[model samples]
Target chain A: MTKTSVNLENPQGYPEVPPKTDSVSPIVSRVREVLRRHKFAYLSVGTYIASMVVFGLIVFAKGSNPFSVFAVVVQSTMFNGGSIEQIVLRTVPISLAALAVAVPARAGLVNVGGEGQLIMGAIGAAGVGLAVGASVPGPLTWVLMALAGGIAGAVWAGIPVLMRTATGASEAVTTLLMNFVANDIMLYLIYQPWRDRFSSGQPQSQPLSQSAQLPSLFGSQLNLGVVVALALVIATWYLLKRSHWGFALKVVGGNQEAARRAGLPISRLLISSMLVGGALAGLGGMLNFAGLEIQLVPGITATFGYIAFLASWLGRHDPYKVLIAASLFSAIALSSNGIQLNFGLNGSIVDILLALIVIAPLFLSKNRKALTK
Target chain B: MNGIEQTLIGGIAGGTAIVIPALGELTSELSGIVNLGTEGCMLAGALGAYAVTVATGSAEIGIAGGAVAGAIFGLLHAYLTVYRKADQLTSGLVIWFLALGVTGVLGTGYVNDAITPLPIVSVPGLSQVPWLGPILFRQDLLVYVGYFLVALIIFVLHRSRIGLLLRATGERPEVVSVAGIHPNVIQVVAVTVGALLAGIGGAQLSVGYVGTWFDDMTSGYGFVAVAVVLFASWRPLRVMVGAYVFGVALSAESVLQTNGIAINQYLLDALPYLVTLIALVVVSRRGGRKAPEALSRALTDVT
Candidate 1:
């Protein structure tokens, strides 16, 4: 009995390993494990709450009802019918942009040029829609405009890809730099002689014909673009999960060396990834112009490409998840009006909050063991 | 006196905005990380300084506040990219978006009113010196600091022991770690310094060049800085030359416009951007012949 005393430590000066115990249900345990593993997830969600509370407190300090303000945020975004429509309308481009990014992200590529590409695409679509407002039939005109926009976006993105492949340039720099080029080009269009003749001195483009506009989904401002967005999501989900080309894309993403070894066309995949991504963004531009404003404005995109990047990241490039993330972002943008009315906060704060929510996950995962490896 | 001089002057002023962010980015890249958030940091610095200037009426305080704001953004970027190992591109883009959105909101109050800009301080005989005088000496104090910073950066990057360590870390962190130094610590410092410079640069734009701050005032100067870094080939002297060259191109549009010349103002405004793009193509086309060996991995990988 004395010799049978339990050993607290092994001879190696480490604690004795315990024997396996009863396992929790796989499904339930997995859910708990994921939540536990990703502390950043909780932290990010908490950041959303904390930012609101802090903003509310500041509002109160400035002489307002913090509670009522908070209530309004929830009510406008979540419960109101008109507000919900506005949110959905905002989600259209963002979701498309997310898909644009996610399509390439699956191949382990970063597409920082979404902002530029989206704008270029919008400009392209607007150009076609504006130029051919009454010449072509409505449906044919819409298709042509969408295709033109997508092609322009692809071409814009193609320059960086070609450079990266041909000269070993960093796409990050090139893509970013291209953004300015695209912006300047757009500015030149809006400000120079190409400026809409109707606006005496202002810098804006002519509005598209009423027939060029995408029909509303119902009585709301939401248009056929939402349907297109949903369709793309479903198509993407299927392609990624079930198609061979998607498999090839995943392989390319997993490891370039391995993909090369397996005789996969790495260069083709790289260029195509960027092309498709750009095309999607361009399609988003068409939707935006056709469904929402029916015109091109200087700040029309309003950084939707970036918000899409966040959505893609939050969704981890999964189509279903992208849908959810896009919807959430749209809600945030919609609630911005409420936030402004009640708290005197500008709508841009919505972007700030969205960004914080998007990136805050990093802080909470600082000590993760897997990250160390 | 002519279009050339006007373009040259305008370019010099606008180019100042690109310098700090480029320097900061150069610092980060040299220390083994690429900050995508330079755009955001620049915006934060610009807006922060503007907010401070309006509230405090001190350009120095505004610049300082801008630096602080930039440093905070840098720290956040470092913690995410370095510590948590979050996707560098992801964190950077997020930061950029956050800055754009947040700063846009905070910047609304100052949109209508104009703040007093920094007065020019000439350096005596240097200010009177012919072509060089107007080009180099007839600007605010920040302009002089820009040149001094370039020289200092060159000196520090080449002559100091820490510089060697930093360069080595940028090339290969594993090698640096084997030598028993903390790569993360060095990277954090590099990022912070880079961000600080960027903030100062941004402040110069709103306070030194222009008399007031407006939303989106940066107009992608931060992005131009990235191109500048590439154009410079990671060398300080070359960066100075490149920055000035970009500056000249920017000023060209204004000079042309002011002269009553029949030119497309938009096309002129687009020149710097187009030139930068062409420069990038030309530089990149030079291939492995000119690129820093360490950058090979970064160029191919998305992150």
Candidate 2:
């Protein structure tokens, strides 16, 4: 047994050689290191192109010219005036939704409840808007509606926070489940007491008064909500990059035990980060409702929360990048309508494209250590 | 039969659909790979099976196609997580989004189509028994297969050497590797098999229960199966019971509505999710010592 025993460490029974360092030039190694460092960037671009090609192939398979689909999507989403306004309107909510995920992510928490929080925010805004739209001055009503929406989002987000702090449950699952609950709650409200009496058949609340509606900007279809979203993005960037609370959140996210040892209030930070995230999403919901919807209706959020989650991930949680990613997603979403109208393709084709963009980079790059973090 | 009896029977059938996926999830989790994309796999399976059934006019072939579709997605997940070392949760979510989009696009054609659903086969004399007969004996072939499969899983998990090795691989992959086996292979197999079961569950939902296909028809049952696995504490018998409990909760609204009970439909729709949350809270508070050590580490941020 001793004679036949194999050394696992050197199973091949080959002598070790060390000549690689001398053969390879220092400049070459330096170049290699730089390439490796920028590998993810290259992979991201490659994946994006690959995803577009795949989408083109899918369109081609469906018997429509791939070039036409691309042309239609871009022309409809960007070139057309009405569609451009639609894209901007859509971007506002999506940007906020992305911010909602980005904030909590800075605290190392995955808040998938943005959808629920967004819904709650819409409900809160609508509740406030309806109650005071007829009585209070328009400006005050809008302010109150925004505040109520923010508070509702915070409260909705706060439930999972409390659950996480009290019991070590996964916020991902809880938040996902809570979205359904929020939808139900909204459904109950719209169907029962909030039903518009004059509307007859549709399940929706009455339209907000003219004063309650968000004013258009510069005589265009664009509204004040886009400005609000941009301001919030800048504020989020400042908070994440330059504030004591943000620094504490980064510390907490990096290492919870280290933060605790450093005397940071871990629970409070977690709760507050989530609350802020919820508030941002809520604000987005309010802006969306007030600016575009002008009334509470079923599917008001319309998966903006989920799309925002994707945008945040694509942006790597950076506020500026999230804004860009949100805009890109909005373009894709808006273009889906054009593809459906022109090529008879389903609107969900955009989902496949988005999923491919996210997944294809994994296939291109070997370094996955970034994902675990 | 009375409304109570009808409700009970319907609950059993509903529960059976959930149980198949829950069992599959339990298997995957036991191997330390949490596939959150079970819902996606189920959707793919539902569409795949429905399509095949429509094309070939054979329910069995449709079921097989569904399992194959699930296995393909499972392989994708395994490649991303086990080979590429991508984050399991993120990979699962990506796979889900992929399935959702693909199915939504392809399944639009089949939305209005119908197929001959799997017929219920009652046991000869036992099906005639007063109360328990219809609930237990009169069920589709898949339900009976599920029962046998559960029993087989219990045996394999508790009584077989392979089962012990699988459990060991999940708990301590390093140890398994040292003992001359690749743990990754085991993990991949477990996940693929688990996804296969989830797909079958989806097939059951479309063919055995609904008899029709729709876009995203599995809804959140795959996620519910994840919760059900937790609710069962990774035990086979408990998984069966938990699935039925969820099934009952799901069917309660329709049963009440059918019986002329005026309830807010949305509230009933929300019950299963609420129950899942409550169950998760209660179970977590009680401490999850029964969870595989490596799986707990995989899921939670706590070191």
Candidate 3:
């Protein structure tokens, strides 16, 4: 049997005292407590430093100058104009994907299906846009695709939420399982049903018509999805921090039994949180497709959803902070290209850096129910 | 061989890989630590086995290397969850990422390298048996070990005092602690042993089954093993059955492709996970109260 109740032990991410160490500067520790609002920033910076050190050792072991390679990574990722645009473009999907995780997390649910949700969103968007054809106006196509993607994402996410509500299945496991299924679903479509007529060998869906594409911004590499992502971030902040629904969800998350006794509609809050999360992820997938990728391609999601999962945890499930975490992760993920071309390392080595950063904060966090329920 | 023959022949060996890990997972889950990073352990083991086998000419030693490699990942997970009290699912997922990256970087040079696979040996007397002989007796040393391990785990987990201690830890650690036995020690040991076997499973895939090392090559087998443990309801025998079921799903994908059938390979690739999802739902709906009492209460608890 799985968890009888939603196992939400730690809502405040890493709310533990820093492990006492000579390296933990007194000033930093004081700042973490004084500027509680900026604690995530400090946590990120700390994680970044720790990851760099570990990454340096790895590079050194590989017979490379860690300092020089890191210099290249930072310079290429932050200073180069084209690189900056790519990072921003990457952030569009990542931020929305992180929001996909963050929203559900606010209700004490872990929505690890962001990757699957995003893929479904892309498939939904592509299917709708292709069917709408070039006859439809550009703005109309966008709305229709967004709706299709959002609904597809919501439905995908809803399946797991339903399973969790009905049977105490852990959302974490079910959602992760759904991701692979979603990818296969996409592969099946592109392989036969949605196979592009013009493309050969590499199976892909038909490219969206020119009118269906999201417009690029100011002749740069980025698209108008940036604005959409930003607006959603602000909206999430308001909803999570200010709204009645948000309060109800929090009540449910904080104490399910208490919320139920209070007649706050516990199951409704859980389902609504997950639905919003899934819809955002779907929107992310659609935006990524229409904005950057011209057509459905293999590995298109490219671990964007996974990184966004880490980003949400990094942000402690707050919308504004998630935006920052997404941006940081976007930079790190984009730096993979630089590392790949220079160090001749596999592109996936970046996951080590990201994983290190994410896990570092766990050492300090105190889960009140860590050893007890 | 006919298509059905090929699936059975292929599935038994493939099933060895999953069942090994599933058995290991059963041990840890019984001790109350649900290590989702079993996938990471398998990946690490696959690479470790391959690299060691390449460096040394012994597949036997490679299997040991694989066990050690997997155990390290398991140990890390144990530390994070058991001592650090980090969230188990998150920690498990992060461990997978860490293993994926580490293996990807380390296995880069071995991508094109190859090793001589473990030769299959059939039991002389058993080989002549009507049907069960070929499917059960004809396999590599690792497959034989898997068979032995299953019987060993089932017997030890049920009949031994240690098994009772382990099961007791999962049920209520506080009560176990009251009996003067530290539950954390037992949990650490159980999780490590589970990972050790999972690593051997990876070695079985690389050295005994596939004979090649590739990045993320275990695919979803590691995860499937985790799901198998869940649906198997922590029963060792049922876990083995579940593993074989997924094993056939994997084999059918290849068998259909080889038979010139036009079914979508990707769709076939998804069947195991879909089945796993459905199994979790269906089993849970049936009052799935077979988990350790403590574990079922706090899903993320490692204590």
Q: Which candidate ranks first by lDDT, i.e. highest?
A: 3
lDDT tens digits by residue: candidate 2, B37-58: 8989999889888999999998
- List candidate 2 segments past 4 Å from native: A1-38, A200-202, A364-373, B290-293, B300-303
RMSD of 3: 10.1
DockQ of 3: 0.49
lDDT of each: 0.78, 0.85, 0.86
Docking category of candidate 1:
medium
Report lDDT (Cα) of residue A126, candidate 1. Answer: 82
Predictions ranked by DockQ, top down? Answer: 1, 3, 2
Q: Which stretches of candidate 3 lie over 4 Å from their true place?
A: A1-48, A367-373, B297-303
Q: Name the regions of candidate 1 deviating beyond 4 angstroms.
A: A1-66, A192-195, A199-203, A365-373, B112-114, B177-180, B288-303
Better candidate number, 1 or 3, judged by DockQ: 1
- Model 2's alpha-carbon lDDT is 0.85
In candidate 2 the C-alpha lDDT for residue B12 amounts to: 81
Encode model 1's per-residue lDDT on B165-256: one tens digit a residue: 88887887777887688888888899889988888888888888876777777777777777788777787776677777888887776666
> lDDT tens digits, residues A72-123, model 2?
9789987887887898899998989889888988988888788888899899
